[model samples]
Target: MSKDVWVIIEHQDGAPKKISLELLGRARELAETLGGTVVAFVPGAGVSNVAESLGSRGADIVYAADHALLQPYTADAYAQAVSQALQAEQPTLVLVGSTAQGRDYAPRVAARLGAGIVTDCASLEVADGHLVATRPMYTRKTIGTVVFSSGGIRIAVVLPAVYSVPPAEAGRRAEIRAFQVALDSKGVRTQVREVRAIQRETVPLTEADVIVSGGRGLKGPENFALLDALAKALGAAVGSSRPPVDSGWVSHDYEIGQTGKTVSPQVYLACGISGAPQHLAGMSGAKYIVAINKDSNAPIFQLADLGIVGDLFEIVPKLTEAIRQAKGRA
Candidate 1:
């Protein structure tokens, strides 16, 4: 395999996703170490501008794969296109974000190329000319290190928020190349007809820097307003434990636990969550955790950086007001 590192870019709203930029940043570092070029592979319909935008963001070469069928993101089309490119180029290492789309297509690409892949990697480094990756195992109770056998392409699916995004350098441009993939449009089975969105003011839970989450103690669906206020004041996202989701108090999109979305935010505020093991499996990677619960002995308190023993009904409004006042004065 060539020493080049290829980053399969994921985009939304015609711009690269945050996780894709993070992968590019890490790929830049790896490429520098390997004395190789950082190559960004962007596949979508009318994504030429997106490829150009990545030029200043540490990519030495940008491959623009524009096609009509690539839009709306069908895993079948993506896996087929990327696997073919990988088989032709055979880059030394490939980096993909562990986002929903990445998790789905990356494995298919690896399978098609007969390459070794490690998913949900929290840490990555090159040692002795080999890529070493670390991932949380067994609900994050332990960390597992994976080493690949020599003589083939290696792929790693990275978790979000684990690495910092590098600042873009203005006026820097990379060599842009046009990539083409052959596909039978009629054979594409999966087609996205429409997208229905959940109307919420808060940022998406996985991408939020701060998260304010609740649990069974929220009592009812109406109580989520408390979390909404706090999340709004802190410019955070609102999330929930499985208990609240199971009770139909909130959508499953808001659930943060083993059976739900895994998040590693800068700060996570747990309101009335008891910190079940399954729940902790998803958010144990947060930089700081604050738990508010009436039960002093709640399991969440043990993992919390700061624990408040009090009724959330009384504490939430006050906390929201305090944050608003602080922001107002600033």
Candidate 2:
């Protein structure tokens, strides 16, 4: 019987991605409840150190595939490697982060293995020795629980920042298995020509404890400078709604909505944003929400813990100044 739980580890520049560790934590819990072992799969160039770290984060085994062909993310290569590994180990459930890379590769891997694939899962549970996944539907107004009956294995692509990372334990031992790579040069349709990583001053939106988001109500793209100033003063990350992203005012990576990143920060400050259901679905898990908008009837106010009715242009600057003073940085 398929019994082990496997989490695919994602990394860049030799450092593990935060969501990969979070997956390990959640997988560990599920494995414990199901009386199974938790394993991790890391595919890249020279990723043994990353595999070691996964062991410290509750993985019973680490499958490392370090090869030149696996240097950059290619859907075919990843699918081939993971599919082969799954055939060898026969894990009952496999978890992947719902990031862009996983969004592309998870379905391919599931198809190759003839398994069930559930995307953008917000919650996971083990019921009747099967993995049941829950994801939002109807623009986040409702949730649907999916139970896989594929028999071979179940796969889930989890949203980032929805789950917390487990504590790392030092000196944890894991069986490290070196997997062989099977690359089909003919099947590799796309080649990565270049990789340009964005260097920004603020923390990543998915990892930030506090987030300050804005929308079309800011009026213009240049006005985002004020939003940045407030975010810097509050030591928070800046996020945007779909309108801003669709308007090309901000990069898609900075967008927080059903179509973008899902963040559950300790505090979410929405300024000049009309809370479309899509945007709220991404940030509703925030511990506290504060909305600042000129229209008192904005949908955002309904979900906010504190709602301020005023012109954001006039209010944001004063709020930024006040926060700076409170921090003694004025």
Q: Count of backbone clashes for each model? A: 0, 0
Task: Give lDDT tens digits, candidate 1, residues 5-120.
Answer: 99999998789988888889999999999888999999899998789899889999999888888998999889888887888888999999988899999999888888999999
Clashing pairs for predicted structure model 1, backbone only: none
Report lDDT (Cα) of residue 157, candidate 1: 94
- lDDT, each prediction: 0.91, 0.88
- Candidate 1 matches the true fold with a TM-score of 0.97
The runs of at least 3 residues in candidate 2 whose Cα sits more than 4 Å from the true structure, single-residue gaps closed, are: 328-330
Candidate 2 residue-wise lDDT, 116-202, digit = tens:
889989899978866788888776788899887668788899988778988888888789988887777677788999998877789
Quote each prediction's TM-score: 0.97, 0.93
List all candidate RMSDs to the true structure.
Answer: 1.3, 2.1
